[model samples]
Target: MNLRLMAALGAALMAGPALAAGGAEILKSQCVSCHAVEKPANTSFERLWERKGPDLYYAGSKFNKAWLEKWLQNPERIRPAGELYSRHVKGSDKEDVVDESTMTPHVKLSKADAEAVAAELMKLAAPEGMVEKGAFKGEKVSMSMGAMFFNKLRGCAACHSAKAGTGGASGPELYTAGERLQSDYIYSYIKNPQKIDPHVWMPTLNLAEPDLQRLTGYILQLSASEGK
Candidate 1:
């Protein structure tokens, strides 16, 4: 090989580990206070409720890398109500409302840091067989049918919103799920949320295979049309 080519190859090889190490260091310093990089031993309801942010132990399995990278640079609220729904909720005799003032915004990172952090986060994978491969077959569902299933049949809209400023706020907004999460993770989580996080408030719906596929497709479609 030419000397110039050999030098370039050497730099590329060295950059990978260096970047990962920097990412790990950034995560430890900046993110570990709120997010769990490793799975926690204590998963009690009280412990889970006290969490400041969603667990990142399975980020690689859960999030799309490109979305994660971009989102880190310009962090936006994915969970409208807050990480712990109970904390932000204020109850009156008539109804309970989320105290938007209490919601904390995520700290944004620089472009270089975002790239490094996303790369490191993508290394935190779920255990073997946790996310089924090829679970979502890129199925397409009509907006009307998908809306019926998400809003009326499954009542998912009670917790998650299919559109911005619409539906419930207790759960993370589904309007961004397509761009934010991995397809297989979305399908797997919908199938059984507790299987992934035993203390999560989301119930096990025990949906049939077809229903699972359709719902996942609906969420993906809804997310795709969010900004447009």
Candidate 2:
């Protein structure tokens, strides 16, 4: 099935009550204050501090439908510090003394609202083939190898945390990435983050194909272990 059509189907299949409750109007009133449905004209990390929330311009391309539905109803802190990490402080000692005022929890949605919103967000699309099938499905990497690449080789630990409630607070925690993200999306983003979010804080690393496959496989392994 064409992925874009999935969004439409989501809305159509919503429990009748959720469909009856205006989804678009609910999104506009509750979500637009923070998230952007369309691509923003600007794409500069320098101006990232001004962003109220993460862009959902290509959300349909980026997120897993099941994950999105579940997350909408039970939102969690993806970014530990804040949307603009520089503005929030955790100190050099890695203390948990972050100023809580800098961050606000996502607006909690009722099951009906979450269903409607997830449906609407899923409708947001990107260019075709952004994540080709089996793109990131490659050779498996041992946990140790994945750890070495993530922590030492790629220096990803500087921003992203490999485990929940651990590592740097600047980026989203990858502890549950495999559970939350689609492998093809992960591979495509790693290959060219700029293609995904041009002004994203994550750098564009021209990692070799082998390294990319290893990293992708590693995250999947990590998530499965966590699930156990």
Candidate 3:
């Protein structure tokens, strides 16, 4: 569940190459409101904006640009399956407020401007400052510890996933949290999830800093590369 484990998982998700420093500034300013390059771990999205979307902190690393440009032109249902794993389970009665119409469109932007923004966003990296080698504590998390953390302590699987038959279905599936998210952003979100989403459907439980780290570690271990 430490940083290394998560990085390992995310690395596998990098199926294709990536390029940064294109004209993503406009994209950042325009699309970043909901798709922030941040995290949401410890707070609910409701307190942050009364409405918020998932973070784009690792867009460059996780998604393909062809898909992104197409998305800008006409978004597909990425989050429609729900952030955690809506495709797998039944979500609450409340429907998501975000719809295709609410997304920012590039129609107003000149073709060049839209492309530039898309280029910049394609360069983004997951905010990882802690997934360095030798970052985990001397002791690895025992299965008991991992199990307890997953089910009892952090219970991240609720909105997240680990190995299936666990976690939540309200957010993105966590079966690959390691490769998908930047660790530093995860840390930041755990410290203050409210900063990312003011109106997140998730609840905000007061988790201690160290506990958050443990939870992050556990979540990261669910990365995609371990078996790959």
Give the poorly placed runs of model 3, Cα more than 4 Å off: 1-80, 83-119, 122-140, 164-166, 224-228
TM-score of 1: 0.88
Candidate 1: Cα lDDT at 163: 86
Worst 10 residues of 1 by lDDT: 219-228
- Ranked by TM-score, the better of candidates 2 and 3 is 2
Candidate 1 local accuracy as lDDT? 0.89
Best model per TM-score = 1
Find the 10 residues in a row with the least total lDDT in model 3: 130-139
lDDT of residue 134 for candidate 3 = 35
Candidate 2 per-residue lDDT over residues 24-78, each given as its tens digit: 7688888887887777777776656677887787777777777777888899887
Candidate 3 local lDDT, 63-93, one digit each (tens): 5465455456644333334443322344346
Q: Model 2 scores what on Cα lDDT?
A: 0.78
| Residue pairs in candidate 2 whose N, alpha carbon or C atoms collide under 3 angstroms | none
- lDDT, candidates in the order shown: 0.89, 0.78, 0.53
Residue range 178-207, candidate 1, lDDT tens digits:
999899999999998977877788888899
